[model samples]
Each structure stands twice: as structure tokens, then as C-alpha cells.
Target chain A: MRPVFLIVLALISQASLADSPPLERQQALLELLHQDCGSCHGMTLQGGLGPALLPSALEGKSALMLTATILQGRPGTAMPPWSSLLTQQEAEWLVTQLKQPAPPQDANRH
Target chain B: MRNQNLNNFRYFLVCLMATVFLVSLPRAPLADVRGTGDLGLVVERTSGSLTAINSTTRRAVGKITGLGDLSHASLVYSPDERYAFVFGRDGALTKVDVLENKIVKRVEQAHNSVGGAISQDGRLIATSNYDPGGVRVFSADTLEKVADIKAEYGDGQLAKVVGLVDAPGQKFVFSLFEAGEIWTADLHDPKNPKIQKFKAGKEPYDALISPEGRYYIAGLFGEDGLALLDLWNSDAGIRKIVPEYAKNDPKLPVFKMPHLEGRALVGDYWFLPAVGHHEMLVIDRREWKVVRRIPLDGQPVFVIPRPDERQIWVNFALPDNDKLQVIDTRDLSVVQRLTPGKAVLHMEFTPKGQEVWVSARDDDQVLVYDTETFREMARIPAEKPSGIFFTARAHRLGL
Candidate 1:
């Protein structure tokens, strides 16, 4: 009975890990946030045609709401839906990253 | 005999010392003494640097660094093509001497700037600002503020300026994105400009002046048509053309805005990139009517014409940004489709249009191709490149 319970626990953990993107994919998504999304929103997310995505600007916004916006996009604006490219989990991950304080200047590789 | 040998040794020493002195002196000044006609600049967007390239040698001669926030940077050259007035997104106006490969003067002109233009006579430089929305003109040589024209609208509200271009008669034309108006500043007198305003359509996102500097056309983002103003006939006011081109079609999502520039006009037909659609709209310039719609691989970003106007090279927005297509002007058909690289940002033709240089930002390389044979000629290393401006633009109107 103990062996069977341990197998079930391991399976559940594996399923959860599979839901999240891999390490390499997370890096790629961060790059996309900086470059592709940066084209409209400033590279540092300070705002251009689009609004700033900095932590200060997004302080009141919920992570889930931001994720939904990323997935469905704002209609009638220049912001287009990124659902075709990003999954729900990935979009949520990006939102969390945006909500955090920007890294140090030297940390930006590019 | 010993005295004669000693004299010869002294002569040899003198020659060796002279050769060393000549070689040790700075060679940069001598090498930089060249005409600016063959020079160009590549905006390394990510690095906040400009790679000064030589079209004749097809090599990057020098890299000018320290210009801040070059993500959406653009520049116009002096009439002599020696100085490049770079407009940064951070509202920094930097005048760079391309020959000297350094910044002559830099001023944080505004909180944010979209682009800029130099006057027809090349004496004044005008920058279109996004933040604290207004147009500021400066002395091209001194970078000193000459005039300030705020884009004030209803109840003192400011509107961001876009698509600023230089016109023929020492004039500057630009569109107010939020206010839906077009303003022309006649800077015949550097300090005082005669400002003319016209009511345009819903949202004028970008604009371009005609090659002959006769007409100013602004593309509307809020509506289906474009606003055209005839500089030759100021009394005619602004006319909306192709009002029903996309009225019946469902609007698709636009990842990037289509750039409206001077090269869209090819002879009688004006080839323009339709917003939110994977198509190129070919309009009859004489009647200002949509004549044909050529389907494309993706939403066209830039519809650039080759120097001779025989072919038009196009790059698309995201999801199809890696692909580049060329259209035959005569047939109005897609002639060639090539996958140059990731995020193909901008393209520029040689002075005579024999070869074209394309910047692929994500790949960190600029690919040069032969226009006639459709062959890859060369590849230049760059850091997230965007705009490729050649000195030949100095002589052309509305570049």
C-alpha cells in the first residue's frame, strides 16, 4: 500500500512539471517579451505605442487578468492576441515576470 | 675608410627613424578624409549604436556608440551628407559627423521622440515628439532650439506626432496621431514658422510626402481611407481617398503598423501595405482609387521600391517577419519570395539600385542581395539592426 501511494504522488508531480514550459523555453519567452513585445512597448517596457509593463504600472492588475489580456489581447487597439503563440501557462508565467522589479542594468544580456 | 663607413651608418639610421615616425602618427585622420556620398548608417537598435557603413566598400568603417534608446531611431543627413541628425526614442537628438564617426552634439530635446527631418535647405532640423507632444526645430549645425510648435488640440490636450517629413519649400509636414490632424510648418524664417492646420480622418498614424514634394498623404488607423493633401493646391484642402477599400472586409489583428513612406509611389500606381491584411493595395495615383489588391504572405510592414522602380521589395510583420517578398511592378505579382532571416527589419538600396542591403535583427546580420539576379551578395554582422539609411537619401525628398 505504501509503495502504491508513493507511485501516485510521483505521477502527480510529473504531470504538474509537464504543464510548465521547460527552462530553455522560458528563456526564449523572456527574449520574446524583450524583443517582439518590445517593438510596440518600449524594450525596457517603459511604454511607446503601448503602455508600460513595469511593476509600478501593473501593481494593481491581477496576474490572471494580465494573463488573459496577453492571451485574448485588447480589441480595437494595436495590441493583438498572442494566444496563437503562447499557452495559458506560459502567458501567466510572463505576467509574473512583468510584475517583478526589473533586473539590474548589468543583468540585461543584450 | 672608417669615417666613410660611419657616415653611411648614420644615413641608414636617419631613414629608419623617419619611417618609424610616419608610421606612428595617427592614421585615422587621413583614412577618414573621404566624401560622404558613399557612406550610410545602420541603427543597431538594441545596442544604442550606429554602424557607419561604406556602400562602395560594403564594409562597416566605424561604430558610434552612446546614443540612448535607439529602438525606433531614424536620421536625416545634412545637405552635404556629412552630418546625420539622429532622433532617438528617448527624445535625444544627436548630430553625428559620419565622416568623423562621432557625435557632434546631442540634446535631450523631449521626453520621447518618434522621428525627425531636415529642412530642404538643410539648415534646420525638426523633431516630432511623442511625450509633451510637439514639434521642435533646431539649428542643424548648432543643435540650438529655433522654434517650438505644440500639437495642442481640444481643450489644450497634446497629441503625439508621427510621420514627420521635410517638404520642398523649407517646410516640415507631420500628422497628429491622437488629434487626427495634419500640420504644415513653413519655416522660411527659422525663428518664426507659419503653421497651417487641416482636419484629417480618424487617426493619422503615419504620413509621407510625394516624391516631387507636391502631396502629403497620411494613413488612417481608425478608418478605411487615407487623407491626401495637395501642396500644389492648398485651397483644395484634404481629400479622403479609397474610403471603401476595406469597408466590407473583416479587420484582422495587426501585430505591427504598416509604414507609409515616399517610395510607395511607383509611376502611376501607388503600392501601399494594407493594415491588418496580408495584401498590398495598388492605387491609381491619378484618380486616387484602389485599382488592385495583390495578396501577400503576411501583413506587409514596408513596401519599398528598388531605386530604378522595376521591383518592390517587401518585409512583413511578426509571424511572417522572417520572410521577404519582391513584387514585379509591371505585372503587379509576387516575383520572388526569400527567407532572409529572422525579424527582417529594414532594407536599403545602393545609390544606383544594383544591390540591396537587408537588416535581419534577430539573426544579428545584414544580408546584401543582387537585385537583378536575386542572389545573396554579402552578409554584414550587426546587433539587432533596424533602419538602414544611405547618404543618397540626403538628395531625395521625404526619405
Candidate 2:
């Protein structure tokens, strides 16, 4: 039931992307990755219950390795696969963003 | 007449000694606010300060500052509930007078530290360190170093210590995050202590003891399941409960590591957050078997069963962070889905379980609710408040 709903949502999201502005889609995806993926990957992507997702932390790991880990999470670990919710292209795009520097953290946040 | 005069003299002497003791101790203007230390401390993560709130009045009494990087900070209160020991992420341990709202003493004990626990006797404070990968004990009264025990496991390598807490008989129980082991230090003799060790699950992230101090359960992050230790009988060793429960279940991404600080002691059952799943696993404390699973909106970060065990109030990790759920203990179903605001980090019920206060981190406010109706009673502004610790914690065995 859940998988079927996710598939329908994916189809609608894709169809809407063609009609919706590209910048809006990009913003939504960024928010999805930042807030959704950031839940496990750490808010700053530094690390939490899961491993660190920082650029320096991912230094040696190739882009292919990260993309695979995102789409089809590593078995025997807490990392869950994002393939059902994220498209292949979206996963690849997320890897590129993660490879870049972390956003500026405000002084007030811990 | 002569005997009566002697008795009166004796009574006068006792009063004189009581006055001397009171004068010797540091005085605070608002120490006796509620007659009992039932006030709560809100850890303002971003601000590196704690806002003291009068639980009954629903107002901020005062704020104490100067602690550094409280990102993962944890606090424990003195037995009398007069002071709070703030354990900072930067490895600093500070003693603050809750009544006075000031840092009485602060010391940089390690390069980095997760948190600490105060000994059962309230005479010793032991810290779990990340840098030195060991536990350090300090004098609670003066903040002076007393003992240092290195958490070395295989090949003489020191491991980062996590889940440090004080148990009965003046013992500090903790787990090694890297070494996959648990150790109990007998601070009965603080200077020269005895230690008992047990092998726990892989990467036991954090652990909590039962309200009665019977079971020490550690949530394994690196692997599925948890490590259960029978503190009553250490010789039985550690047992794995719900062994590989995650293996058979569908892949669920654990949003954040569930904090095991609060006990899920609802009746005879123990409720715990399901790793990477939107559910709460209920276990029969007698056999430690799953009796039921309560489906929730998202991953539960804290499964805090109220003081009376009538209901369990839960908070989630982000993107479901803004929601709060109230589960009826009798039916084991959610009774309320509270939309408090963004990033509901932690919750604390009043000592009698009458009112629950929750910290909405991103909202920068702590919402107070009546437990019976689940109504928002008050909203107090805060700065990235994460943990809501009340003075009633002093009486609990393992906070």
C-alpha cells in the first residue's frame, strides 16, 4: 500500500515538474534533501545516529558510491534506501550538493 | 527544676548547630520558590544557556550563561535539587545553583564530552568523554578531580564512553560506544574504585535504567536490537533483546537516534522507540518479549511515559518534528496528535504527571500542556530549547 502510494506520488511529482518552473522544483528538492535526508544524515551533515555526510567526511568516497548508497541504502545498517521516494537523477543531484561545502551555520544554533 | 533547665539548654544547642549549617551553605534569594524544587531547566542549545522555569507558575525564573557549545549537553541535579551539573559538548562540566541561577563552579574536564552522571551519594560527578575516550570522576562539592578510569577494550585502545549514569550503591554505569562494552565503576570508594565489565551490543549509542534501577537497556545504533543488562544480577551478563528485529522488518530510515533518557514504564510493560520505524515497541518487563507495537506518525525520539504511567507523551525527529502524540496506556492507541510547531525536541511531565512541557526548538518556545486534556496551557519563549529537565529528576534513580 505504501509503496504504491509512493509510486503515484512520484509520477505526479514528475509530471508536475514539466509544468512547474524549474527553480521551484529545484527548491522543493533542496528542501526535501535538506530537511528529509538531513534527519538521518545530520542537520549540518556532520553526523548523528548515522555517519557524517560532510564533504570532508565524504572526501574519498566516489560520487557513484554515494549515489548508490542514497538510492539503495547499505543493508545491515540504519541507512534506508531513498529509491522509492527519490528519482535516480535527484539522488545524483543530491550527491553533488553534499560534495560541496556545508551551508553557513548561524552563531546561535548549537 | 534543675533537670528541666538542662533539657532546655540541650534544645537551644541543637538550634544553634542548625543555624551554623545554614549559614555555611551558599544562600539564594529564590531557593524556596515552590516549597520543593519542582522547577524545570530548559537547555537553550544555540544560546549555550539554561532557562530556569517555575513549573507551577509557567514563567521563566532566570537564565544562566557562559557554558560552551551545548549541542549535545545533558544535565543532572544534586540530590537536594538545589544545584544542577551541566555537561557541555565541549567537555566542560559546570555546577550551577538552580535557585541562585548562576554557575558556582566550572571546569574543562576533557577535550570533548558527551555527558555525565552524578553518583548516587551525590558526592561524585563522572563524565563520559569523547576525546580521551575514558570516564573522569570529580568532587561534586568543589569540582576537583578525584579519579580517572580509562575505557580501554581490545588491543589497549581507549573507547569513547556513552550512557554514563549512577546506579545504586554509589556505582557509575556506562557503555563504551566504540568498544561495545558496558562497565560499572564502584564509586563507593571514589579515590580507589572497583570496576565490573560486561559485553554489550555493537555501538550501544545510549542507555537508560529502569525507574527502580533494575534494567540497563542500551539502544544499539550500529546494529539492530538492544543490549539488556540485569543490574540486579551482573553475573548473568548482558542479553540481547529483540535480536535482529530490524532484519526481518521493512527498511525504515531511523530519522534520529532515539534518546533512552526517559523510561517507558507503563504498567508492567516497557515501551521503546522502534529503530528506523514509525512505531513504539511494547515489551513485557517480565519476559522482555514484544507484546504489541503502537504505530506512530513518525520516528519517536523520546518515549516518555508520564509519572503515573497513565499515558506516554512522545516527540518526533524532523520533518515530523513539529508533531506530538499522546498514547492512551489502557488501549495503547494514540489519543492526540498535537501540532505544537517546528522541531519538538523534548518533553517533561510535572512530578505528579499533571502537566507536560515540551520544547519546540525551531519555534523558540516551550509549550506547556495539561496531561488530562492535552491542551496547550502556556507558551514560553526560549532559544533553541532541546531538553526539558525538572527538579523532580533528583529523586529518580537513573535520570
Candidate 3:
């Protein structure tokens, strides 16, 4: 029964990932994560007023947990929640990008 | 004898080249550049320094350097509009000669500061500081320190000052960020000013005196309301308005502090950015009531109306920072939506309301638009330009 539950959970997560926003919207969200998020988290995500978002900094941190934090900002801090601007699935996708090796090319392009 | 002749010939050739080089130079001499401040313009490069442009010709005049930490710098023009007082993020107050495109005098008044205000009489300049938590007044001409009044609140704790502006009666008004109080200092006696104080809202981020210099409204960060003061009637005390604004509603976290200057008064109603929400809260200025809430593309950052009050333009915080919304004053509705490139930091309308200039930070360009046609007219390249200020701003009160 436990094995079956694990399989169902894996399938649900896959379905959510497949529901990612259209290419155009996904692209815009990536820009927001880099520039807007960079305003506090640092342009390069190495950390300034906010904590670093680099993969190295996010190493021991779980992707799901970071997604929750992105959707619901930490209270009593300057880190604002992006849930109003981003969908939960989109937030999850962004967390994945945040843990990637490098920021998107156009993030710094303009 | 032959070698001497050769040396003289070489010297003659060198002098000819030197004369040609000096003659080829284009910009006017420092002495000649004086008194042309009316023709001057400055675009603050967040990186550092200012690129001086001829406001009349729309051409880059020259670059003025050695200004420290321009990341959050603000400017105030002199009475003749011949000079600019630049308040740097590092608390450096620099008096720049607009005509000569040079910094005349610079003094590090505080460890850190946000911005400053010039006295109405143009006799003094005051800076609102973050570090050491106080304000310092200096003489406009000599750049000499006049007074250092600490923003002290309960239990002798010093507080950072914000929303500083010059009142009509030779007084400087500012609010304390930490202590949550408003204070006024009369510069009648420059060395020792008579200070007046009042308790205001919690975490008042910034304040703006009305265009007519009647009301001083400060938006709070710690709470959901504003502190309003009538300059004409100081004894009336500071009253709280827009109470419980977005308090019960599930809202997003405030990413950036909305400026005090963006509250646009379209006749009777003021369209202000609703903190942490995708809406511009409309309040009837007479009753101080939240009469309406106009939905926006994102968190509204800057709210500026045309000089004629025909249209009100707004920019947002993030993700939607690329979009701009314009509201018609006649019907009080969004008239146009503009995508002027990414990270639009600031905008300024023409003196006569012909065009509005917007700074696209990421693109490093100043996008100009024809207000009537609502069309992009020109794009002038700049170096990380954030603020595009006209000398005309000097004429306005509590600007």
C-alpha cells in the first residue's frame, strides 16, 4: 500500500510540472525572478539585502520547501511573497530555476 | 651648430601641433560655461557621477565625476536654477555648478542619508540622514554645517529622518522613521533652530506636502494608514486617515517602499498606490475617505500626473515594472497602457505638458512620449539613468 501511495504522488507531481505556463509567460516570469528578485537577493543572486539564491546556497534546501517560501514570503522580513504575482506551479518552476547552475541569459541582457 | 638648428626645428613643429590640438577642442571653457545653468540637465548614473546635458539642445554636455554612492541620490535645484545640491547615499552633500557641469563643493555631512531639501528662501540646505539618525542643516553658499538636530524620541533613542521638505515660513519639515513623529525646524536663527514636534504614524516611510503646500501626508509601513497634517493649522494635530487600508484583505508583501511624491491629486480625488496590493487606492481629498480602488497591472511604484492634470501615469514594482498605466482625469479611468521597456524607474512630464520622459533603467535609455498622441517620440541613450529631473522642479513647493 505504501509503494502504491509513492507511485501516485510521483504521478501528481509530474502532471503539475507538465502544466507549466506557455513559453512566452514562462520567459517573462524568468525575467521577474532575475531582475525584481535580484533587487533584494542581489543581481547575481549572490546575496545583498536578501539571502543568496545560487544553487550552492540552496544545496541542503529542498526544492519544494523553497517553492513554499517563494509563494509565501517569510514574515517579519523584507523578503516579500510572490504568490500574488506567481501561480503555485509557476513558483515551483521558479524554485527549480533558482537552483540551476546559472541565471537565464536574458536576465542580465536588459 | 647643426644639432642646435635641428633642435629648434623640432621645437617649432611641436608648438604647431599643440596649438592645433587646443583649437580642435569643442566644449566651452570652464569660465565661459558659468551662468548657463538654465541650459543644463543632469541624469544620475546609479553607478556614480552625473552626465550633464544641455536641456535646450537635448545633447550630452559633459560628465561630472567624484560623487560617491549615487545609488540613492536625490537633487534639489538652486533658486536661480544655476546650481544643484546632490545628496548622495553615502551622506555626501555636493553643490554642483549646473552651467559648468562641475561639482563646486562637497562635504560628507553624515555617515549615510536618503535625500535632502533646500530651504524656501534658498539660504539653507537640510539632509535627512539614516545613519546617526538625525538631520543636518548647512549654508547654501559656503556648504558650512549650520545645525545638527538629532531626531530623538522615547527614552533618548535617535531615529532616522524621512520625508523632509521646506515649508513656506522658512521652516524645514520632516518625519522620523523609527520614532514615528513629525518635526519642524525654523531656520530663522541658522546656528540654533527652534524645533517643533508632533507624534505621527508608525514607520512613516515617506511624506509629501501637497502641490499647494497645504497638507503633509505620510504613508506608514508598520501599519495600514496615513498621517495627515494641515500646515495651515499645526495645532489641529496629526490625524490618521485611510485606516485599515488592506488590513483585512489577503495581500502580497510590500516589496519596495512607495514614494511620498507619487500621490496624484486629480482635482478632488487623490490616486495613491495601495501598499502590497495591485490597486491604486482613490481617496476623496476633502473627506479623506477611500472612495474607490482601481486595479493595476502590479504593485504601483510611481504615480505622476501630467502638468495639466489631464492624465495620471503610474509605474509598478516588479514583474510588472515593464508596464505603465495612464488614467484620464476626466473620467478617472485607465486611458492607456504602455510598455516602455524594462525596469522603468522614474518619469517626468514636460513643463508645458507636451511630453513625458521615462527612465528605463535596464535599457539605459530615456523614452520620451507625446502626451497628446500617447506615442513614443524619442529614445535617448543614457548610462544607467534612474532619475530624469527638469530644472523646473525647483519652482514647485515641497516637491
Q: What lDDT would each prediction earn against the true structure?
A: 0.87, 0.80, 0.78
**Per-residue alpha-carbon lDDT of candidate 3 for residues B289-347, written as tens digits (9 for 90 to 100):** 99988888888888888888888899988768888999887877888999998888788
lDDT of 2 by residue, B130-195 (tens): 778899999999999999999998999988888888888899899998899999998877899899
DockQ of each: 0.33, 0.20, 0.16
- Top candidate (DockQ): 1
What's model 2's TM-score? 0.80
> Which portion of correct inter-chain contacts appears in model 3?
0.23
**How many steric clashes between backbone atoms does each model show?**
0, 0, 0
Stretches of candidate 2 off by over 4 Å are A1-103, A107-110, B1-36, B222-224, B247-250
Candidate with top TM-score is 1
lDDT score of residue A110 within candidate 1: 56
Candidate 2 residue pairs that clash: none
DockQ, candidate no. 2: 0.20
TM-score for candidate 3 (chain B): 0.89
What TM-score would every model get versus the actual structure? 0.89, 0.80, 0.77
